[model samples]
Each structure stands twice: as C-alpha cells, then as structure tokens.
Target: MAEPSTARTLTTEPRRTPPAPRSVGAYPLLAWTWMRAMAQYPVSLLLLTFGQAASTGLELTALFFVFGHAHQLAGFGINEALLIYGLAGVAFCLADFFMGSVERLGEHVRKGSFDTMLVRPVSPLVQLATDEFSPRRLGKVVPAVAALCYALAVLDIDWTPARILMLPVLIVSSIVICCCVWTLGASIQFFIADAREVANSVTYGGQAMTEYPLAIYGRSVVRTATFVVPLAFASWQPALFLLDRPDPTGLPEWLRYAAPGVALLMSLAATLAWRTGLRHYRSTGS
Candidate 1:
C-alpha cells in the first residue's frame, strides 16, 4: 500500500517541459540591441558617422562630376550610374554598420575570445555582429537614403503600384547581398586564420564593380561575377529594371523580382557554411 501511494504521488507530479525556443523576431533582435547601444555612445558615434559622411559624400560628388561631363557610359547616364552607386552605398554601409565588427573574426579567434562567445545561449554570429556598434558609419545611410529618394523623384520611375512595391524590395535585396558577401569573408577566417586582404577584395571588389555598367566587362569577368561571386543580380540585373532598360544580358524581366530571393538564398548558404566551419573551429592556440 505504501509503495503504491508513493508511486501514485510521483506519477501525479507535473513534469516540466523545456521552454520552447523563441521565434527570431522580424527585426533581428541583435540589430535592435546594437541600435540601443549606439544610442548610448552618442558622441563617438556622431563623430564617426559625420566623418564617414564627409568622405563618402566627397567620393560620390567626384563620381557625379566625372560622369556628369561624359553623360553616359555603356548607354547609362550620370543619374543612372548614381542610382546604382547610391543603392549599393546603402547596402554596403548597412552591412558594415550592422555586422562590420564581425569581420574581425581572425583577431577574436587568435586572442581566444571566441570561446567566450561559444558559451552564450545566443548565436556567436549574432553576438559578434552586436559586439560593437559604430554610430558614425550610420552617417552613410542618411545620404544614401536621401540619394535614393531624390533620384526616384527626379528620374522618371514609371511608378506603378508594382514598381513602387519593388522599391523597398530592391533595398532589402541590396542589404542581403552586402551582408552575404561580408559573412562569406568572415567564414573564410575559420579556415585561413587571416584572410583580411582576400576578404577586403571580395567585399570591396563587389561594391566597386556595382558602381558601373557590368555590360562593359568581358564575358570571363562577367561569368566569374555571375556564377562565382554573384554581383550581377545585386546591381546589374536590377538596374535594368529600374532604368526601364531591357536586360541586354538576355535575363528575363521576371528575374528582377528574384533578386531578393537570390540574396536570401546566398545568405542562407553563407550561414550554412558558417555552421559547418564552426564544427571544425579549432581556437587559434589549439
């Protein structure tokens, strides 16, 4: 009787189910934390943001001046080129502002600080991106957004409801492309120990290439960028849609909508590569 009663009591006690994993919110939770932290470090952030703004503004101004005189390259005008540059600018800076700090993976691994990241409940990549928020690079975003807005106003955008809808979609595609490139560079750090130069080339090269008509480039370069690096969809293809110019590259019109999808796929691939690399992660000293 005593044993039966004890067994019943034990069986009646509620079993604690493990907490369900929280859904990743619409805005990356880590990105929100970074925005808050940047708010806290106001002065340093402002100075950096302003400095970046000044430098980038000068570069864009120079580009405008040079291209303005010529008026066209490979059947593209100054305004059209600026549109491409402006969009690419926002993409690159957002990636830097959000996850730029993570580009220092080699240093973190070398110093053995990566282990500290491993112990956390959240992802190391998320933690890494949030670790340092540069308030200054945010200066770049304002001008880029302004340029985009102004360009849309000044240029004939053929603003149908569908085209209008695609505007925000284009910006997101740009962001994904930039972040994917950055993430890919960071992933290489897991293997090469110090992939800084190669990383810079990949990130900066894509940005530089997107500033002009990709059509002028040779087939070999174009193929390498298309299948290998994937800079084509981010700027080249979408620019065709924006300029109302038919894609001379023979890519379909419907493909413009696919840019964001391609970007998402690339980002997912980079993430999977990151996870696989993490499994083989040998902290620098070991």
Candidate 2:
C-alpha cells in the first residue's frame, strides 16, 4: 500500500501511423521491374542478346550477297535494301522488346489469370502488359539500331527533315501494327483454346515481311498484307517516302504519311476483336 502511493504514474506514447505507399507511373515502373527481374539471370540475358545480333548479322550478310550478284529488287538497290531492312529490324526489335508478351496472352487467358487481373485496382491490360516487359528481347534492338545507323551513313540517300522525322513514325507505327496483329492472334485463344502456332504465323510472319521490299512479294500477297492486315503501312509504304520512290500502288504520296494512322485503325480493330473474344472466354471451373 505504501509503495503504490509513492509510485508516480508513467506516461505512454501513442503509436505512429505508417506512411502510405507511393503510386508509380505505369511505363517506367514496368520497365524497371523488367530490368530488375531480367538482371537476376545474367547468363540468359547475355546469351539472348549475342544470339540475336549474330542471327540478324548473318541474315543481312545473305541479303548483301544476293544483291551483290544482282542490281536490285523491285526498284531498291543493295544499299537501299539494307537501309530499309535495317529500319525494319530496328522496328521489329523495339516492338518485340516491349510487346513480346502479347504472344503469351492466350495462355494467360486460358489459365484464368486474366480473371485474376480483373480484380486488381490497376487497368488489367496495362498491368498484364507491364508484368511482361522483356529486356531479353533488346538483344535484337542493340545491333539492329547500330546496323540502322551504319546503313544510313553508308547509303547515298539525301537527308531531309521530313525523312529524319519518318524514323520515329516508322518505329511507333510498327509497334502498333504488331500489337494489332498480336491481338488478332490472341483472339484465337477464345475459340480454339490453343492456337499458338497459328497466332505465331502473324507475329513471326509479319516480322519476316519487314525484311524485304513489298514489291518482291507477288501483287496478290502485297495486296493481302496491305488491305487485309495493313502490315505494309508500317514499313513498306513509309519506306517509299524515305527512299523517294514512286508509289506503284497508285496510292497518293500522302498515303505513306498515314502509317501511324493505319496502325491506329488496326489497333482499334484488334481491340474490338479482343473484347469480342473476352466475352467468349469460358473459364475452367475451380
């Protein structure tokens, strides 16, 4: 009793609240996440990068050899051909680097992971795409851009402000075109549940188309690619503007300037197709 009376009351401190989590921008965060995750596998990263460089270099060499024996193909000379090819390579590399995982959307949807995405606060498409950023694909980009720069220097084409501006237009337009083709490919998963090879036909096949002048292919094939898929707008058409070649398709000179526009249209169509496919997605029972 005497001890309790003598004791002074102790003051207690209140607990501090934790800080709120910081929100991150989608693109930068996605890129960082990809870089960090990819860095974890140093050996695999190096192998992919070097492998892409070698394969592309070899392919270009073959094209050089072919054109060395012949004057030109479809009005483009060897050096001009390389310039176009290199530009396409850069476009492909950049597209594949960022949007490569679009190829895997089928599997994600089939596995019900797409459903999991619907519950998140972030935009499903953006989050899913960000989660899949692949720097390993940059393996192709480094050499492709390097080759493009080299090709530009070696080639005799006159440089104009308009031509210089076309470079970025070509890259962004190609990305949109590829994304559209990929969405079309992904839509098959809704019906077949597994149509990877067929989808790849567009992804890989589209990339293949970029390696040559559109005129090398038969008129029928070119028409199908241009009107049906609009792949030609990404590389072939804009290329005409850069090379100062006349449009044999009777398409106006301004049409080449519409590469980004065509790409946007294709992308919208692909999105509509995707929405149609999503409604058709039948998730397996848990």
Cα deviation at 67, candidate 1, in Å, is 1.1
Q: Give the per-residue lDDT digits (tens) of candidate 2, residues 135-176.
A: 667767666677667777887766788788787877788777
Instruction: Tell me how candidate 1 scores on lDDT.
Output: 0.76
Task: Give the per-residue lDDT of model 1 (tens digit) for 136-209.
Answer: 76887777667766766778778778777887788788788778888889888999988967998978777777
Worst 10 residues of 1 by lDDT: 18-27
Residue 202, candidate 2: how far off, in angstroms? 1.4
Best candidate (score: lDDT): 1
Stretches > 4 Å off in candidate 2: 1-24, 249-251
lDDT of 1 at 247: 62
- C-alpha lDDT values of all predictions: 0.76, 0.74
